[model samples]
Target: MRLSPSLFYTTNCEPALAFYEQCGLGRATILLRWGDNNMPVRTETMRAKIMHARFEGPGVLFHASDNDDAEPMKGSAMMLEFDDLGRMRRPFTRMSEGGRVTVPLARQVWGTSFGMLVDAFGVQWMFSCSNE
Candidate 1:
Protein backbone atom coordinates (compact mmCIF):
# COMPACT_ATOMS: atom_id res chain seq x y z
CA MET A 1 0.00 0.00 0.00
CA ARG A 2 1.14 3.53 -0.71
CA LEU A 3 1.10 5.85 2.28
CA SER A 4 0.64 9.56 1.95
CA PRO A 5 0.73 11.82 4.97
CA SER A 6 -1.80 14.58 5.45
CA LEU A 7 -0.91 17.97 6.81
CA PHE A 8 -3.58 20.15 8.36
CA TYR A 9 -2.91 23.84 8.61
CA THR A 10 -4.86 25.82 11.14
CA THR A 11 -5.27 28.83 8.89
CA ASN A 12 -2.25 29.30 6.64
CA CYS A 13 -2.57 26.62 4.00
CA GLU A 14 -1.71 28.93 1.15
CA PRO A 15 1.60 29.92 2.66
CA ALA A 16 2.26 26.38 3.75
CA LEU A 17 1.65 25.17 0.23
CA ALA A 18 3.95 27.83 -1.15
CA PHE A 19 6.60 26.95 1.38
CA TYR A 20 6.55 23.31 0.39
CA GLU A 21 6.70 24.24 -3.25
CA GLN A 22 9.75 26.33 -2.54
CA CYS A 23 11.24 23.31 -0.83
CA GLY A 24 11.11 21.54 -4.24
CA LEU A 25 7.78 19.82 -3.81
CA GLY A 26 5.46 20.19 -6.80
CA ARG A 27 2.60 22.68 -6.87
CA ALA A 28 -0.66 21.98 -5.15
CA THR A 29 -3.30 20.11 -7.11
CA ILE A 30 -6.86 18.85 -6.78
CA LEU A 31 -7.69 21.89 -4.69
CA LEU A 32 -11.13 21.89 -3.13
CA ARG A 33 -12.63 24.93 -1.49
CA TRP A 34 -14.95 24.72 1.47
CA GLY A 35 -17.96 26.44 -0.07
CA ASP A 36 -17.70 24.61 -3.37
CA ASN A 37 -19.56 21.63 -2.02
CA ASN A 38 -23.16 21.64 -0.88
CA MET A 39 -23.24 21.80 2.87
CA PRO A 40 -26.09 22.79 5.16
CA VAL A 41 -24.00 25.38 7.00
CA ARG A 42 -22.97 28.84 5.87
CA THR A 43 -19.61 28.62 4.13
CA GLU A 44 -19.39 31.94 2.38
CA THR A 45 -16.75 33.19 4.77
CA MET A 46 -14.79 30.00 4.24
CA ARG A 47 -15.09 29.91 0.49
CA ALA A 48 -11.44 30.73 0.07
CA LYS A 49 -10.32 28.17 2.62
CA ILE A 50 -8.76 25.02 1.23
CA MET A 51 -10.86 22.02 2.08
CA HIS A 52 -8.35 19.69 0.42
CA ALA A 53 -5.15 19.78 -1.61
CA ARG A 54 -2.56 17.33 -2.89
CA PHE A 55 1.15 17.88 -3.33
CA GLU A 56 3.19 15.34 -5.26
CA GLY A 57 6.74 15.23 -6.53
CA PRO A 58 9.75 12.98 -7.00
CA GLY A 59 10.02 12.10 -3.31
CA VAL A 60 6.85 13.48 -1.81
CA LEU A 61 3.13 12.93 -1.84
CA PHE A 62 0.88 14.39 0.78
CA HIS A 63 -2.55 15.89 1.38
CA ALA A 64 -3.20 19.24 3.00
CA SER A 65 -6.22 21.12 4.27
CA ASP A 66 -7.21 24.19 6.19
CA ASN A 67 -8.72 23.24 9.52
CA ASP A 68 -10.10 25.46 12.21
CA ASP A 69 -9.35 23.10 15.09
CA ALA A 70 -6.01 21.83 13.87
CA GLU A 71 -3.14 21.90 16.31
CA PRO A 72 0.54 21.56 15.42
CA MET A 73 2.24 18.30 16.26
CA LYS A 74 5.32 18.81 18.40
CA GLY A 75 7.18 15.61 19.02
CA SER A 76 7.14 13.74 15.77
CA ALA A 77 9.21 14.68 12.75
CA MET A 78 9.05 14.14 9.00
CA MET A 79 12.34 12.80 7.70
CA LEU A 80 13.32 13.11 4.05
CA GLU A 81 16.10 10.94 2.67
CA PHE A 82 17.93 12.22 -0.35
CA ASP A 83 20.07 10.27 -2.79
CA ASP A 84 23.12 12.44 -2.23
CA LEU A 85 24.35 15.40 -0.26
CA GLY A 86 23.99 17.74 -3.23
CA ARG A 87 20.33 16.87 -3.55
CA MET A 88 19.68 17.87 0.04
CA ARG A 89 20.98 21.46 0.03
CA ARG A 90 18.40 23.48 -1.85
CA PRO A 91 15.38 22.03 -0.14
CA PHE A 92 17.10 22.24 3.21
CA THR A 93 17.82 25.93 2.74
CA ARG A 94 14.33 26.71 1.55
CA MET A 95 12.64 24.78 4.33
CA SER A 96 14.80 26.39 6.98
CA GLU A 97 13.84 29.97 6.21
CA GLY A 98 12.47 31.71 9.30
CA GLY A 99 12.66 28.37 11.06
CA ARG A 100 14.74 27.13 13.94
CA VAL A 101 17.50 24.70 13.13
CA THR A 102 17.81 22.01 15.73
CA VAL A 103 20.73 20.39 13.94
CA PRO A 104 22.79 22.17 11.35
CA LEU A 105 23.63 20.33 8.16
CA ALA A 106 26.89 18.50 8.60
CA ARG A 107 28.66 15.25 8.10
CA GLN A 108 27.52 12.65 10.56
CA VAL A 109 29.47 9.72 11.90
CA TRP A 110 27.16 7.42 10.00
CA GLY A 111 28.72 8.73 6.76
CA THR A 112 25.77 10.89 5.89
CA SER A 113 25.03 14.59 5.79
CA PHE A 114 22.08 15.38 8.03
CA GLY A 115 20.17 18.25 9.55
CA MET A 116 17.01 18.95 11.46
CA LEU A 117 14.73 21.95 11.74
CA VAL A 118 11.30 23.10 12.74
CA ASP A 119 9.76 25.04 9.89
CA ALA A 120 8.00 28.38 10.18
CA PHE A 121 4.72 26.51 10.20
CA GLY A 122 5.90 24.49 13.20
CA VAL A 123 6.54 21.34 11.22
CA GLN A 124 9.63 19.37 12.15
CA TRP A 125 11.78 18.04 9.31
CA MET A 126 14.95 16.02 9.10
CA PHE A 127 16.97 15.99 5.88
CA SER A 128 19.60 13.37 5.20
CA CYS A 129 21.67 12.07 2.32
CA SER A 130 24.31 9.38 2.15
CA ASN A 131 27.90 10.49 1.71
CA GLU A 132 28.90 7.34 -0.08
Candidate 2:
Protein backbone atom coordinates (compact mmCIF):
# COMPACT_ATOMS: atom_id res chain seq x y z
CA MET A 1 0.00 0.00 0.00
CA ARG A 2 1.17 3.55 -0.71
CA LEU A 3 1.01 5.99 2.16
CA SER A 4 1.48 9.74 2.04
CA PRO A 5 1.48 12.65 4.43
CA SER A 6 -1.75 14.62 4.15
CA LEU A 7 -2.11 18.24 5.16
CA PHE A 8 -5.13 20.48 5.61
CA TYR A 9 -4.90 24.16 4.82
CA THR A 10 -7.22 26.90 6.04
CA THR A 11 -8.67 28.02 2.70
CA ASN A 12 -5.64 28.30 0.44
CA CYS A 13 -5.87 24.85 -1.09
CA GLU A 14 -5.30 26.03 -4.64
CA PRO A 15 -2.40 28.27 -3.70
CA ALA A 16 -0.95 25.50 -1.59
CA LEU A 17 -1.21 23.09 -4.51
CA ALA A 18 0.67 25.54 -6.69
CA PHE A 19 3.31 26.05 -4.04
CA TYR A 20 3.88 22.36 -3.48
CA GLU A 21 4.07 21.79 -7.21
CA GLN A 22 6.73 24.49 -7.36
CA CYS A 23 8.47 22.81 -4.42
CA GLY A 24 9.18 19.79 -6.63
CA LEU A 25 5.88 18.01 -6.14
CA GLY A 26 4.14 16.59 -9.19
CA ARG A 27 0.71 17.63 -10.44
CA ALA A 28 -1.93 17.30 -7.73
CA THR A 29 -5.41 15.93 -8.27
CA ILE A 30 -8.52 17.67 -7.06
CA LEU A 31 -11.18 15.16 -6.10
CA LEU A 32 -14.03 17.55 -5.41
CA ARG A 33 -13.89 20.09 -8.21
CA TRP A 34 -14.19 17.80 -11.17
CA GLY A 35 -16.89 18.10 -13.84
CA ASP A 36 -19.34 15.73 -12.16
CA ASN A 37 -18.43 13.60 -9.15
CA ASN A 38 -21.46 14.50 -7.05
CA MET A 39 -19.80 14.67 -3.64
CA PRO A 40 -21.86 17.51 -2.26
CA VAL A 41 -19.67 20.17 -0.65
CA ARG A 42 -21.34 22.01 2.24
CA THR A 43 -20.56 25.51 1.08
CA GLU A 44 -20.91 26.72 -2.48
CA THR A 45 -17.84 28.92 -2.09
CA MET A 46 -15.78 25.77 -1.63
CA ARG A 47 -16.67 24.47 -5.07
CA ALA A 48 -13.45 25.97 -6.37
CA LYS A 49 -11.48 24.73 -3.38
CA ILE A 50 -9.26 21.69 -3.46
CA MET A 51 -10.62 18.69 -1.63
CA HIS A 52 -7.46 16.66 -2.09
CA ALA A 53 -4.09 16.72 -3.80
CA ARG A 54 -1.45 14.04 -4.10
CA PHE A 55 2.16 14.76 -4.93
CA GLU A 56 5.24 12.57 -5.28
CA GLY A 57 8.48 14.19 -4.16
CA PRO A 58 11.79 12.54 -3.27
CA GLY A 59 10.00 9.20 -3.58
CA VAL A 60 7.33 10.11 -1.07
CA LEU A 61 3.66 10.99 -1.40
CA PHE A 62 2.33 14.22 0.07
CA HIS A 63 -1.35 15.11 0.27
CA ALA A 64 -3.11 18.42 0.89
CA SER A 65 -6.53 20.06 1.04
CA ASP A 66 -8.45 22.95 2.57
CA ASN A 67 -10.16 22.86 5.98
CA ASP A 68 -13.50 24.62 5.60
CA ASP A 69 -14.60 24.39 9.20
CA ALA A 70 -12.07 26.96 10.47
CA GLU A 71 -11.06 24.69 13.30
CA PRO A 72 -7.53 25.19 14.67
CA MET A 73 -6.32 21.63 14.17
CA LYS A 74 -7.86 21.38 10.74
CA GLY A 75 -4.86 23.21 9.35
CA SER A 76 -1.77 21.38 10.51
CA ALA A 77 1.95 21.82 9.82
CA MET A 78 4.74 19.66 8.48
CA MET A 79 8.31 18.83 9.44
CA LEU A 80 10.03 17.34 6.42
CA GLU A 81 13.11 15.20 6.79
CA PHE A 82 15.76 15.18 4.11
CA ASP A 83 18.63 12.82 3.38
CA ASP A 84 20.41 15.16 1.00
CA LEU A 85 21.43 18.24 2.90
CA GLY A 86 23.14 19.76 -0.14
CA ARG A 87 19.99 19.61 -2.24
CA MET A 88 18.00 21.13 0.62
CA ARG A 89 20.22 24.15 1.35
CA ARG A 90 18.77 26.24 -1.45
CA PRO A 91 15.07 25.46 -1.01
CA PHE A 92 15.24 25.67 2.76
CA THR A 93 17.03 28.98 2.66
CA ARG A 94 14.73 30.38 0.04
CA MET A 95 11.67 29.36 2.05
CA SER A 96 13.02 31.24 5.01
CA GLU A 97 14.29 34.31 3.17
CA GLY A 98 11.07 36.28 3.61
CA GLY A 99 9.37 34.15 6.27
CA ARG A 100 9.38 34.27 10.03
CA VAL A 101 11.84 31.91 11.62
CA THR A 102 10.61 30.19 14.74
CA VAL A 103 13.85 28.26 15.07
CA PRO A 104 16.94 28.91 13.00
CA LEU A 105 18.44 26.00 11.12
CA ALA A 106 21.11 24.73 13.43
CA ARG A 107 22.50 21.58 14.96
CA GLN A 108 20.40 20.49 17.85
CA VAL A 109 21.31 18.52 20.96
CA TRP A 110 19.98 15.45 19.22
CA GLY A 111 22.75 15.78 16.59
CA THR A 112 20.61 16.88 13.64
CA SER A 113 19.97 20.14 11.85
CA PHE A 114 16.41 21.43 12.25
CA GLY A 115 14.48 24.65 11.88
CA MET A 116 10.94 26.01 11.90
CA LEU A 117 9.18 28.80 10.07
CA VAL A 118 5.82 30.33 9.26
CA ASP A 119 5.67 31.29 5.61
CA ALA A 120 4.18 34.46 4.12
CA PHE A 121 0.89 32.85 4.96
CA GLY A 122 0.15 31.83 8.53
CA VAL A 123 1.14 28.24 7.86
CA GLN A 124 3.89 26.71 9.97
CA TRP A 125 6.53 24.42 8.49
CA MET A 126 9.62 22.59 9.66
CA PHE A 127 12.68 21.10 7.97
CA SER A 128 15.33 18.77 9.28
CA CYS A 129 18.53 17.20 8.02
CA SER A 130 19.63 14.02 9.66
CA ASN A 131 23.25 13.78 10.79
CA GLU A 132 23.25 10.07 10.18
Candidate 3:
Protein backbone atom coordinates (compact mmCIF):
# COMPACT_ATOMS: atom_id res chain seq x y z
CA MET A 1 0.00 0.00 0.00
CA ARG A 2 0.97 3.62 -0.36
CA LEU A 3 1.52 6.23 2.34
CA SER A 4 -1.41 7.33 4.45
CA PRO A 5 -1.60 9.91 7.25
CA SER A 6 0.96 10.02 10.01
CA LEU A 7 -0.37 10.80 13.46
CA PHE A 8 1.37 12.40 16.40
CA TYR A 9 0.07 12.76 19.92
CA THR A 10 0.52 16.09 21.59
CA THR A 11 -0.73 17.79 24.74
CA ASN A 12 -1.77 20.89 22.84
CA CYS A 13 -3.55 19.98 19.65
CA GLU A 14 -4.56 23.42 18.52
CA PRO A 15 -1.02 24.80 18.59
CA ALA A 16 0.36 21.73 16.94
CA LEU A 17 -2.13 21.98 14.11
CA ALA A 18 -1.27 25.63 13.71
CA PHE A 19 2.41 24.75 13.50
CA TYR A 20 1.81 22.19 10.79
CA GLU A 21 -0.38 24.60 8.90
CA GLN A 22 2.44 27.12 9.03
CA CYS A 23 4.76 24.48 7.66
CA GLY A 24 2.73 24.53 4.43
CA LEU A 25 0.21 21.85 5.30
CA GLY A 26 -3.32 23.05 4.76
CA ARG A 27 -6.25 23.27 7.16
CA ALA A 28 -6.63 20.51 9.72
CA THR A 29 -9.81 18.78 10.78
CA ILE A 30 -10.15 18.92 14.53
CA LEU A 31 -12.28 16.49 16.46
CA LEU A 32 -15.24 17.92 18.29
CA ARG A 33 -14.52 18.88 21.86
CA TRP A 34 -18.13 18.52 22.86
CA GLY A 35 -21.58 17.77 21.45
CA ASP A 36 -20.20 14.80 19.53
CA ASN A 37 -22.01 11.64 20.41
CA ASN A 38 -18.87 9.45 20.23
CA MET A 39 -16.74 11.21 22.80
CA PRO A 40 -15.15 9.16 25.55
CA VAL A 41 -15.75 9.94 29.20
CA ARG A 42 -13.49 12.37 31.09
CA THR A 43 -12.19 13.77 27.82
CA GLU A 44 -14.08 17.05 27.84
CA THR A 45 -10.88 18.99 28.46
CA MET A 46 -9.56 17.62 25.18
CA ARG A 47 -12.71 18.54 23.29
CA ALA A 48 -10.70 21.43 21.98
CA LYS A 49 -7.41 19.63 22.34
CA ILE A 50 -7.77 17.85 19.00
CA MET A 51 -8.99 14.35 19.47
CA HIS A 52 -7.84 13.97 15.87
CA ALA A 53 -6.76 16.21 13.00
CA ARG A 54 -6.09 15.74 9.31
CA PHE A 55 -3.80 17.87 7.13
CA GLU A 56 -3.48 17.30 3.41
CA GLY A 57 -0.61 18.61 1.37
CA PRO A 58 2.37 17.60 -0.80
CA GLY A 59 0.43 14.48 -1.77
CA VAL A 60 0.03 12.98 1.68
CA LEU A 61 -2.36 13.13 4.59
CA PHE A 62 -0.85 14.03 7.94
CA HIS A 63 -2.79 13.56 11.14
CA ALA A 64 -2.14 14.51 14.76
CA SER A 65 -3.91 14.90 18.08
CA ASP A 66 -3.65 16.11 21.64
CA ASN A 67 -4.28 12.71 23.06
CA ASP A 68 -2.05 12.74 26.07
CA ASP A 69 -0.74 15.39 28.46
CA ALA A 70 1.46 13.25 30.60
CA GLU A 71 5.15 13.21 29.64
CA PRO A 72 6.66 13.99 26.29
CA MET A 73 7.87 11.14 24.21
CA LYS A 74 11.62 11.08 23.63
CA GLY A 75 14.00 9.70 21.04
CA SER A 76 11.28 9.47 18.44
CA ALA A 77 12.51 10.29 14.96
CA MET A 78 10.73 10.49 11.59
CA MET A 79 12.62 9.66 8.46
CA LEU A 80 11.42 11.22 5.20
CA GLU A 81 13.30 9.54 2.40
CA PHE A 82 13.32 11.71 -0.67
CA ASP A 83 13.88 10.80 -4.28
CA ASP A 84 14.55 14.38 -5.36
CA LEU A 85 17.14 16.10 -3.21
CA GLY A 86 16.42 19.25 -5.18
CA ARG A 87 12.80 19.31 -4.10
CA MET A 88 13.59 18.39 -0.50
CA ARG A 89 16.53 20.63 0.37
CA ARG A 90 14.62 23.88 0.67
CA PRO A 91 11.76 22.62 2.81
CA PHE A 92 14.09 20.58 4.99
CA THR A 93 16.33 23.57 5.60
CA ARG A 94 13.37 25.80 6.35
CA MET A 95 11.87 23.44 8.86
CA SER A 96 15.14 22.93 10.66
CA GLU A 97 16.30 26.53 10.48
CA GLY A 98 15.76 27.42 14.14
CA GLY A 99 16.32 23.92 15.42
CA ARG A 100 19.24 21.62 16.08
CA VAL A 101 21.32 19.60 13.66
CA THR A 102 22.58 16.34 15.01
CA VAL A 103 24.34 15.43 11.77
CA PRO A 104 25.13 17.87 9.06
CA LEU A 105 24.30 16.74 5.53
CA ALA A 106 27.40 15.00 4.32
CA ARG A 107 28.67 11.68 3.11
CA GLN A 108 27.79 9.14 5.75
CA VAL A 109 28.91 5.73 6.91
CA TRP A 110 26.09 4.10 4.94
CA GLY A 111 27.42 5.36 1.61
CA THR A 112 24.89 8.16 1.52
CA SER A 113 25.05 11.83 2.36
CA PHE A 114 22.59 12.20 5.20
CA GLY A 115 21.85 14.80 7.82
CA MET A 116 19.76 14.78 10.98
CA LEU A 117 17.78 17.82 12.03
CA VAL A 118 15.33 18.50 14.80
CA ASP A 119 12.64 20.94 13.73
CA ALA A 120 11.48 23.86 15.82
CA PHE A 121 8.71 21.74 17.29
CA GLY A 122 11.15 19.09 18.51
CA VAL A 123 10.44 16.63 15.71
CA GLN A 124 13.56 14.87 14.49
CA TRP A 125 14.05 14.13 10.78
CA MET A 126 16.72 12.40 8.81
CA PHE A 127 17.50 13.70 5.31
CA SER A 128 19.65 11.69 2.98
CA CYS A 129 20.74 11.21 -0.60
CA SER A 130 21.71 7.86 -1.96
CA ASN A 131 24.55 7.26 -4.40
CA GLU A 132 22.96 8.35 -7.68
Candidate with top lDDT is 1
**lDDT (tens digit, per residue) of candidate 1 on 6-119:** 888877887888888887867897788776766322345456788889988887888988887789866788889988788788889889999989999999988889999999
In model 1, the runs with Cα more than 4 Å from the true position are 39-45
Extract clashing residue pairs from model 1: none
lDDT of each: 0.83, 0.66, 0.63
* Alpha-carbon TM-score of each model against the true structure: 0.89, 0.74, 0.67
Q: If ranked by TM-score, best first, what sequence of candidates would result?
A: 1, 2, 3
lDDT (10s digit) by residue, model 2, range 1-132: 865677666677677666656666355654455223775676876776777667565555777777677444325566678786776566667666556888887778998888887765456778888954
Q: Tell me the deviation in Å of residue 87 in model 1.
A: 1.7
Worst 10 residues of 1 by lDDT: 38-47
Global lDDT of model 3: 0.63
Residue pairs of candidate 2 with colliding backbone atoms:
none
Query: After superposition on all CA atoms, how large is the RMSD of candidate 1?
Result: 1.9
Tens digits of per-residue lDDT, candidate 3, 1-132, equal 865545555556566567656765456754554325766634656554555667666654666666555445466666666566675566567667678888887677778767888776566777776744
Regions of model 2 farther than 4 Å from truth: 1-3, 25-31, 34-36, 73-76
